[model samples]
Target: MHYALAPRTFLFSHYFATGLRIATGIIGLTFLAYFIADLPTAVAVAMGALCTSLMDMPSPLRHKFNEMLAGVLLCSVVALLVSLSSQVEWLLFTVIVLVSFLASMMVVYGRKAMPLQFAALFVMMLSSEAPSTPLQALRHAALFFAGGAGYMAYAMVVVWRLQRRLKQQVLAEALYELANYTNMKAGCYDIEAGLPAQMEKLVRGQSVLAERQQASRDLILRGRPTPDEEILVQVHYAMFDLYELVLATHTDYELLRQHFAKGTILPLLGDLIGKAARDIEAVAYAMTRNQPSRSNVDYGPELAALDAVLRDVPVGEGEDYDAQAALRATANKIRDVIAMIGRLHAATQASHGALPLVPHTDMTPFLTQQRYSLGILVSNLRWSSPVFRFALRVAMAILAGLVLSRWLPYTSHGYWTALTIAVILKPSFSLTKQRRADRLIGTLIGCMITAVILHFVHTPAILIGFLFVATAAAPAFLSIKYRYTAVAASVQALLLIGLTVPHGGSGVSERLLDTLLGTLIATFFSYVLPSWEYHNLPRLVDAVLDANRKYIDAAADLLLKRTGDDVQYRVSRKRFMDSLATLSAALGRMLDEPADKRRAPDELNRFTVQNYLLVAHMAALRLLMQRYAENLPAREVETALEAMFAEVRASLGAAHEAVPAQAAGQSTWIAAWPGWAPLQRRLRLLQRDAAQVAQSRTAIGAALGRD
Candidate 1:
């Protein structure tokens, strides 16, 4: 048995891999038989099928694929009609282009963008130099449908096995975040920076899982993971617990900082805070791994000990951490979150479908602020003036594409240039830059893969099989966050090479030429659009100011404890968070901009990070102030609020300009307002923190360093 363990193990693993290959081979053989009468015709149909599958790999990929399919189908139908009427090439091309553009645009700006993408490709196919009789065109359309349907079936088979795995990953991430949040409150250090991003991913994963489940039902639902799906639904509830805990942490930290600034507590708490941050980071790392979570490390007794130490420690002010009862209230808030996590975890084990829609918390503010409706086509286009924007971007892209096309050795390179322009003319600079980089890298890698495949397997059947594997792997890879980079890279490679296969490229050099020209055009248009520069310093500064205003206004309302206005306050805070996210995105775009086009913001990205942190601090302060405000008289709090507001305005104005630090420990806002020592001291701390945040500018340095 020990003679050659590695070789034996490899062979064992190979058996399973080989089995899958055989199964796939059988599927391909069956499809091959249907179109055996004409090998070239069969090959064309197979190629189209493969492209559809590959394009459908990512969850979001469907929107693009659907648009392309719809567009293609529509164009094909129209072209068939026209072929029956007339055979003039110029007239056919013109009609196809007009119809396709209108159809694609209808879907793109409509509720779904998937159909529009298909429309574009269909239009291209119809208008291609290859002419066909009406019957022939109709046959091509039927082949396209057949290929599409075959791949759809293929997806159902592969995704059924994957659904369970994806469900487990999603649940584990949600649970880990929940656990980490609870641990942090017990004076432990734990930070999961990826938690927020993971939330977005999990939401998307759930959507996909739902779609797959529906597809499975249509195919033969007996094989689907019904029990696992139920558990996954319970897991979504567990996620609510995690979100609440994080929000509590934000508010708690604000209170903690204020308590410390009062100069009443020892600095011993800082080490514990740092430890909590470390613990959270560790938990985040664990969740990302495929392995099971480590057994719970119960720190209940340790927390009790820490609580005892805090109670015994003498304060100059002789006030407890919970003296104003703010800390205790925050602790209770965190406990509520912990209880929810515990209950949800139990429910997940029990296997449940939908839970009772208990109004545990109001998310109206978060939703209203973050999600913007694109509206119905006619209405949205009327508002956005889509035709005008489209023409402007198209013209810019065409200009850039033409410039790159001139340098390409092949005249056909212009088509890729047009495609490059289309991809680059998105709504935002950051998106354009990301897509450009992704497209270039994907194209390069895909072309190399195609070259290797052509050398080894020249036949259409083998090529189609290869495409199936690529397509199946795409969605699985794109399911996780870290894999997105590779997903984009893989997708670009596949799409470019897939499209070129029918054209019968001369060699690798020609393929490379097309890719390079496409990349050049895409990258060039991304920078030269002369649109609103996302990373403009003034815009960044303005965004920071706006976010600050929203945060302050929300914090004030929360502190006042106006229950009916919760939705408005949450909405305002959500807007503030969005603004911070926008600023971060802008910083990324600035890094990608051409050197000459990239202008440094006045204070740089330091201002952006500071503003972000400031908003978070304000959130925490709102939570703390509301709890603490409960202990004081209503009149006293109102008076203090007015004084604090004045101080914030003055401090903000002074810090608005970049200036050298002065050690006078002067007050920008505090001096202007006459107030009690406690109120003045609290306001002073905010000014100090805001100034420190604004003055620190490491983000810009980090961005430049990456270059």
Candidate 2:
């Protein structure tokens, strides 16, 4: 179980976030009641939260408006169906459940404006509560829509501010990562292990920057292209290439380390690596600020140093030769990268910040197969036993609520009990635990808030108004922080306490009793007959290893210049990512379990980071090879292909440990290198990918278990 530290900053942020949410929640809740005031408040509260939960935080304003409009229209139609089918309550409930599931499935599949989650929750709200009248149900639906709309407006303003803050924050973190890379040049070489995190963060940063660019694109469109955009893209591409070079360097380093005079060449290579890192940092900083003042200053200096180093570097005949030529080549790549950065800087400054357009054919042909396969993988997973788990959890919550209502003095108090349990009954174990703890605490806080209000003012309508404010604002406030579960529990507490006014009882006694009951029931059901066993990490391990095998096969085929059948390649890539995601989640769950319960004979399953990079490198190599293969000269390519085939066969034999050292150890690409087709230029790319996959498979097998 993960421990929740009472970090002072998080606590402070939670409170401020709560305040904002409460304010919007009140307005939203009140707006829902504005048109139709006959409905029970419970249904409205659940639907409101559901709406906020399903909304994408970064969706465009216009897109949100359209989605919300569609949601309202859909909900309205469903309300009509409920009115007609009210005579058969059981039938309606079944229909509601079915509708809810299908709509949610659609959301997951379509990834469209409409969120199936809202529709499902809306159905649940209506069917579970069994609203007394058509007007009452309609009123509840209206309030739910109003609450969601109000919070959405608030989210728009708040998130816009947050996005701006993130830019500076992430940029600072990127610079720090750059510094770390520069400082680690002399450490053990392990590119797949070492540089993946840095590159991943850069990829995420670029995505965020792209969002920011879109935000300002309209205004900047009339102006010339911004040098910043070009510089940023150039930076992005350069980082991509740098990451690849890092991987190649790691391989080269390992090879050299095995036989070279480390005392002679390692020092010089390390210095070159350090210098390249410095150049990267300078370019990153310049790109982040979109400033050119330091470009010529930094770029020119790196190029001068790189050129001097290359001129002095010594060349050797073989792969094992301990010459500095490879180091010089690496340095030259950095200098050429700097030249590209300079071009971007000039282009950006000249174009008023517009992006430089590259005319290219659609990557859709190559990437579509992979993308579609991934979609199917996600869809298949969603339709698995997890769906049953979610449904069962919902049923259990409803049962617990029914049981609690029997003991409560009032029905409204029981509603509170049930809602509380549902709030904390998350789909997974750790989430359930975290929400349970937060639920208990938030309930106490809500009780205190109501008690304090009761002491100062006793009017029922005033109490209702306060509860409304608390409920509506909870979602908006929780929107920004990880304090959502707590905020939600507190909101429910306030609403339930206000509901007690009609029954004429002091809410404190009922509040504590209901909270205790809800917590106990939720905790019991969560552990009893658990839906998934995190301890059995072997299941995930098995899947990952199988996927790794397929990935190896895909690399081998691609390396052989076999792009004729792309389906296997597509399947392999898709399986690789899905398995990776599964492994990541499984590892997390395994780590969460008690020490004895954790599976996987050893920590061998912890190679997720390395495996992920190896997969990426494989994909990149395949793409490069495909591009070259598609343009090869027929006759020349045929002869070169035969030669490459022989080397591949030798490597494969050696991979199985079935080839003699004399034959397998021969140089594979010496003569096949510059001879035949355009595709031959990228044949090395394919070979590198295949080599990494084979090497990684061996390393992982050694680390985990030999198959």
Q: Highest lDDT, which number?
A: 2
Q: Which whole-number lDDT from 0 to 100 does residue 487 have in model 1?
A: 41
Candidate 1 TM-score over all chains jointly: 0.59
What would the per-residue lDDT of candidate 2 be over residues 517-628, giving only the tens digit for each residue?
8888888877654545443444665576577666666756655656655556655755665666666655555556456544442343334544554554454444334434
- Model 1: runs farther than 4 Å from truth? 1-129, 142-295, 298-357, 360-438, 456-465, 474-507, 532-558, 564-568, 599-607, 622-707
lDDT of each: 0.46, 0.48
Residues 627-697, candidate 1, lDDT per residue (tens digit)?
45434545655656655655555445544355334333233333332322334344445556566554443
- For candidate 1, the 10 contiguous residues with the lowest summed lDDT are 1-10
Candidate 1, residue 646: lDDT: 53
lDDT of 2: 0.48
Which candidate's TM-score is highest?
1
